[model samples]
Target: MNTTELFLVAMLIVFSIPYLIWRVFRTDYWAPLVVVQIVTGVLLGPGLLGAALPEVYGAIFTPPVIASLNGVAWWAVSLFVFLAGIELDLPLAWKSRRESAVTAGFALFTPLLAGCAAAALLLLVPGWVGPKAATWQFVLGIGMACAVTALPILILLMEKMDILRQPLGQRILRYASLDDIAIWGVLAIILLDWQRVGRQVIFLVLFALACWGLRWLMQRLAESDRWYVALVWLIVVALGADWCGLHYMVGAFLAGVALDMRWFDRDKLDQLRHHVLLVLMPVFFLSTGLRTNWTLGGATVFLAAALLLAASVGGKLLGIHLAARVQRWQPGEASLVGWLLQTKALIEIIFANVLLDKGVITSGTFTALLLMAVASTMLTVPLVTPMLKRNPGLIGRSG
Candidate 1:
């Protein structure tokens, strides 16, 4: 087949396979369709499907097809991140700043410390650290990966669980939102290129000026017109961020945050997220899966994945439990919040991709982190359900 036809084949596989698995088996209670899509992507990657069917992988993922797929994936993630930024709810986070700050701090830092310990231990084993990484970079990068919470996936889960509009739900969003901002800040530190410091500084300065002008223009546009303008703004910011060496996603997010969330209808914004996931994000997941590797041996990757999972889960629970104690939260609240906050998917994958792109972690480490993210996310609903059932008061905080 020509590259275009082959690309369509690739697209068919990306959409059809995961959906079939999700719908056929009724995995919704345990794993959402989104999670299934991510898993399907991993299964279809070179480590598994590619190894078993090398000819198939080679043919469908030809140079041109792969390039085309990546283009779709880039835009998919760009839109997704921009939505996440628009949904940040900074005003709410600020209103509860004291509680939110304490919770976010504990939630983010504890996992970071545990993840750092796990990353350090990983160094004793070979094939986990990328060749281009400094020891500091690998350690911190892996640590931060462990600490990430997938904000988008968390929203999906909360909505499914019927807590999204609840007071407690908003509270959880506050904590996660604060941590989300910190996650990017840490990434900027990890991605800082001293030789390109001049470029990055210039980008920030110019970006600030541009944001003022952009927000001013956006404020004056009709709500309907704002939608189209936002897309243009997203692309422009992504391009500028990429050029400054900070990465396009950073720009996409900043572009969203610069504008007022009140400008967009909440329902439309939510639908946009759903549609983006349904159409374009699967390609991003497929592209993500294609990068998985097991050259260090599948068993080693599994073991490392297990260790990281323990660190991530244990640290998150510990951190939340501590905050619960301080805040004098009701019983069962800590466990529930921890399990929910531990949800990680696209954001974790994106963070790892950045690390891999920068050569801070090898494919083996990336695979392990990927596994950890999948496992952590899968555990969220099952773990939270029982607690919610037991505490009838916990369902949307008396709403």
Candidate 2:
């Protein structure tokens, strides 16, 4: 197949998936849409059908093409993160700061402790992973992977369930809002610890200055009479943060928050969401699906995959439930909150990509983590809806 044919095939998959999933089958087919997309990827790549049609497959998914796809996917993720930060109702977060603090602390530490324990256990088992170098990398990487949650997934779920207005939803959202901060801080510390002090210190100092400077500039930009200036400032802040070694999402989020003060027009956020999520995110996910490699299969891989799923879902549920209970939420509501809280969507995908790029994990491991993210999203939606409908009162009154 030539480049033209390969492009056509790529376009077909991209066009067909959304049309088949969203337009034809609608929401009823979402899970299958996800399954089909992933399975189609596996089949069309080196895994199954690709083996039978190696020439065509190789022509399509070459290294240069894959690299280009990743670049596009990264942009999509950056926008998605920015939109997430923008959508975050920081007022609500502040109102529930104590609960948010509890939830955030538990969410971060529980997984870190569990992942470290798992790493130790993995070290005990010979042949479970590769040699010492490989083992340490896998353990630390998997630990970070387990600890990460997808902020985009959680917000979408809450919106769909109409729980964003409710207390349980607010708590979860607030926790998620703070979760990103903690995640980046932990990651920065880890990255710094793993790097030379001079570079690390330079990055940290630059990041602090950038954050402070952006805050000042965004305040000024928020009052701009020209709409384009606001948008430009948003981009500048995002790009600046990206350049400073902070995630673009963090910058976008801070930009949003900075503009979110009482002076800016409330309508700006709605506009941001309209263009960002509706327009950009689907393209990103498609490109992400294209990058998945399922040919690297084995029982050990499957086992590690299961562990990641458990760590993500089970750990979040347990941590949130305990936190909710401490907040004096009833058992039913707390458990339901726990169940609802584990839905991870966008940020997890972004984090997986980051880990993969940083050499913290393999492509195959990232693929498994992505699968876990989709599964967690699907499970949380159904689990939370009944709780929302049947007992809105059960959500929580504390905060």
Candidate 3:
């Protein structure tokens, strides 16, 4: 068949398989459709499907078809990341400064340190760190991957559980929002290219000026115009960031961050996020799957994934428990919040993809991180549901 036919066949597979599994198996209790989609992406990747059926994989995922899919995937993720940035409610976080600082700080650092130690151990083995990475870069990159909260996915799960607008849910959003800022900041540090520093500086300066003018203009435009302008702004900033060697994802986040959420209608913004996930992100997931590798052996990769999952889940809970103690939170609050905060899906995958693109982590390492992210996200709702049921009052706790 021709490239277009093959591309449609691939797209059909991407959208259909995951939806069937989610529906037929009723996996929504333990695994949401999004989580199922991610797992399916891994299973459909070269390491699994290609290894099992090389000719079929090659026939459907021809070079041109893959390129087309990648183009779609890139835009999907950029828009997703952009929406996540716009969702950040930093002012609300700052209002409860002491509590937010303590919770966000611990929630971020504990997993980070644990993941770094895990990364340090991986460095003792071969094939985990990428060829272009320095020891510190690889370690920090891996550590940060572990610490990602997938604020977008977290928002989805909270909405599913009917807590997104609850006091507890809002609190969780605050913690995740602060961590989101730090996550991107650290990514910039890791991606910093000394040779491109001047270009990056210029990009930032121009970006700042552009943001000021954009904000002024956005304030006067109708909400409808703001949406169109935001897209144009998203593309321009993303292009500039890529040119400066910081990665377009960073640019996308910055573009959204510069805009006020108040400028857009809240319901419309939510719908846009939902529509992006439904129509576009599946392509990104399939593209992500294509990048996974098990050259280090499936057992080894699974082992690494298990180790990272333990670090991410354990460290997040430990940190939140400590914060709970300090802040005198309600009895079940820390456990519930920690489990929710540890959720990682799209953001972790994006973080690993950036690391892989920059050669800070090997494809094998990316595969493991991907697996860990899937597992971490899957565990969130199941664990949090029971905790919420047993202590329903926790949902209303403001602090």
Candidate 4:
């Protein structure tokens, strides 16, 4: 069996799991569907099925095939970010910038700062040294991981809840967007220190300037008679950010902010999102699942996972509450935003994978973080919805 055939088989299984779950249960339990796909993928990978059906599974789980699938996943995420950019509304965020900034601040940067503080403190713990030890650098790495928010998933959740155009939804989305930009800047700094300090600093400044230039270009294109030209410029800027050592996501986000400044078209953005979600985004999620290794035999691994889960949940809520107080957000709204934003998804996982690839975090640590992210997200989804409904005047209010 070749990669294609194996992938086809994986795809078949991935597609069928939902139906199987639907048949077994009367509810739309996407989580179980996701779990089955991951479990099945692992079973069919070199771990299990390859050990049993050597020839058939080996061909599909080959290094080249895995790399190819990962590459596809990366591309899918890139598209996801691009569409995320398209969906943002600059005017709305601008109109509500102060409140949104407070929300976004608590939602992202507070946890990041807290994570950094924790990491800095954890560095002194005896014997926690070397490759996997809690060093200052590693602490910084963890902080970065904690600070990230996957806007696509947040937006999707908002849309599904039918609050996307509502006040709370707009406010949450706005803050999340603002937080995304700020976090990218932080990531650029981390990469600079991790990659090349001197060049990274210089490049970061240049990247900021380039973002300004790109914004101008996008705005011009948006206003021009040639609507298609805006998209072309967006692509150029998106790739250009990668060339300049900045994440392509930064470029995509800038493109979105620029688009928001001009014409905010929900229909067009939705169209792009629809295609990306059905086709590419699932590949990205499936690949994320494939990368996750849930098999754990050690108490240490379990402890680490548990600690991370507790920290992730506690940290976000605490951070958001503190930030809200600092920024003078209403108590009800603050609590709502804090609880909801704790949920992690693709962004944190993908970035952590990048960190692992860079040797900033070990594979074992990355796996732990991925689990922490998924667990936090799962817990939040069910919990946040009901909490928000309970506080209609705060988080549930429209306009």
Candidate 5:
């Protein structure tokens, strides 16, 4: 009836419904609870639940309730992305620079080319491109979405599949980590507001200085002290970035990457990540799904999703397979690595959301990319299960 009750109602639904479906149906093998939660967010959004029960949807998700939920969702994703940034093991990547470069480059670029082609076609349609987007921005935004790998989700899926600590899993993480940097860089390009370009330039200069000081302070602190400092740092950097037109998530990532992972205990860092996902990320998923639309109609959105998924999966596999040939990886390794690299749940959604906020892509395109991301993620475990099962020795091989 009131905002608090309604907010609680919304919270209860987001947390409960997805878990119930995931647990009751035993969807863990195919769709993890996080994926299920993302789907649930869509189902509860204007396109589905709202379309079916407009009054109820409006009543529950009133302005105040929506605002409150959004506050949680924003901080949830901010922290999650921050953690993703901190987890990047760039040192490991540097150790295997040659293999990492050729593979990561191809893995990012080929799909980028393919996705641009797909985006070019979508430009021929009207509803898919946002009003504020120039053609180049739209194309590049969609392409980056196609190329993104959800490092955090990839880790989760690999852990579930029991390969996360293995040599293969660690190697896969290196590839994803490099792409994570490129994804944000491209997003900055897409979001570059010429009017704000001066401000952005200033932000970069100051941010560099801040990072130096931040690094020095972090090195001197105890791990316990570092945790609180990191939070303060996350907020300040995120605000500064948003002020400069780079977006707060970019700031969040920069905030984390400025510090070393060795500063925190590895297991505690992992637990903090785990806690963020369990406690807060469901709100982000629901917030993301609420932004989805089928303005051109549901069938059109679904069809677009299918096309994008094909481009994403095909380009990723094609690129990895090519890289494998160049690097002389063993048989079946490309498929295993490519499939794992295609994980795109949280990061892809976050990328699409940023594009949508900046009006670089329309809701129709966002919905399509969101669907593509979920489908690509769901396909990973199912497709890789048989390969890992049959190969037996594929768990940890030197790359």
Candidate 6:
């Protein structure tokens, strides 16, 4: 068949297989449809599908088709990341600064240190670090990947657990919000190019001035007009960021961060998020899958994934438990909070993708990080459910 037909066929597979598995197996108890979609993307990637059925994979995912899918995926993820940035409730986090700072600081730093250690170990061997990466870049990049919490996915999980509006949930959001800001700041640092430092500096200076003007204009415009202007802003900033040597996603996030969530209707923002996920993000997931490479061997990749996951999960629990002691929280609260914060679904994937694009991590390392993210996300609900069941009062505890 032609390229368009093949692209359509690929899309059909992308949507269908994950939905069927999600629906038929009742995996929502453990793996949400989003998780299933991510897992399916890996299974369909070159390492699996290309290896298993090269002819079929090649026929469907030809160069032209892959290029088309990538165009869609880029826009999809840029928008998704932009929305995530807008969802940062910094004002609320500031209102509860001490607890949020202690938790977010510990939660972000501990895993980061652990993941850096793991990255150092990976450096002992070849094939893990990207060609262009400095030692510090690879280690810090991997460290940040391990530390990332998927704020959007965390919101979804909290809603699923029926605690999104609860006191506990609000607290978690505050912690995640602060970490989300730090995550992007660290990303910009990692993406900093000495050769293009002048360009990046100019981009930031112009961006700051433009952001102020955009905010003034947004406040005056109707909400309907704000949406249109926001898209234009997303495109322009993303272009500038990419041109200046930082990833377009960095610009996309900055674009969203410049705007206040209150500027738009809350329900409309939520609906926009939901609709973007439903319509666009699956393509991003599939495109992510297509990038997976296991050339270093499956066993090596899985071992690295296990190492990252251990560092991520273990460090998160330890950090949160320490926070619990400091904050004088009741027993089991740390475990609940830690497991929830350890979630690395969309954000980690995005982080890894940026690292991969910037040559800070190899495709092999990307595969490992992808595996780690999927495993970390899939562990959240099942583990958290039983904890909540045992201590229903935990949800009501505001601190």
Models 1 onward score TM values of: 0.91, 0.80, 0.90, 0.80, 0.91, 0.88
Better of 1 and 3 by TM-score: 1
Per-model RMSD to reference: 2.5, 3.9, 2.4, 4.1, 2.4, 2.8
lDDT of 1 by residue, 31-142 (tens): 9888988888877777787889999888888778878988999998889878877876666667778888888899999999999999999999887888788898888888
Ranking by lDDT: 3, 6, 5, 1, 4, 2
Which residue ranges in model 3 land beyond 4 Å of their true spot? 296-298
For candidate 1, the clash count comes to 0
Question: On residues 286-366, what C-alpha lDDT tens digit does candidate 5 reach at each position?
Answer: 777776654435788898888899899999999999999999988999998999998898789878988888888887898
TM-score for candidate 4: 0.80
* Candidate 2 local Cα displacement, residue 237, angstroms: 3.6
Provide the global lDDT of candidate 2 against the true structure. Answer: 0.62
Residue pairs with colliding backbones in model 2 are: 150-348, 153-345
Please give, for residues 1-399, the per-residue lDDT of candidate 3 as tens digits.
998899899899989999999999999989998788777877777777788998987888888988998899999989987987787665665688889889999999999999999999998889999989999999999899989998767877898999977888888988887787688778878877676788888998999899889989999999999999999999999999888877787788888888889999999988988899889988887676665554446799899999999999998999999999999988888999999997898889878988888899988898799889999998998899999999999898878
Looking at candidate 3, the ten consecutive residues that score lowest on lDDT are: 288-297
Mark the regions of model 6 whose C-alpha exceeds 4 Å error after superposition. 124-134, 165-167, 187-191, 296-300, 353-364, 393-399
Worst 10 residues of 2 by lDDT: 28-37
- For candidate 6, lDDT tens digit of each residue in 149-194? 9876787788789997788988887788678768877887887757
TM-score of 1: 0.91
Model 2, span 1-399: residue lDDT tens: 665566556657655765475556555324524334443454555655466887876777776665665566566666655656555667777776787788777776677666656656655545444222355555765566567766665665566566655666666766666777666655554455443455445655665676577656656753655346545656776776666556677766666655444545567755665566555555555665555544455666566566677777677767877776777766476667667666555566666666666666555666666676677666765666666677767765545
Query: 113, model 6: CA deviation in Å?
Result: 1.0
Weakest 10 consecutive residues, lDDT, candidate 1? 289-298
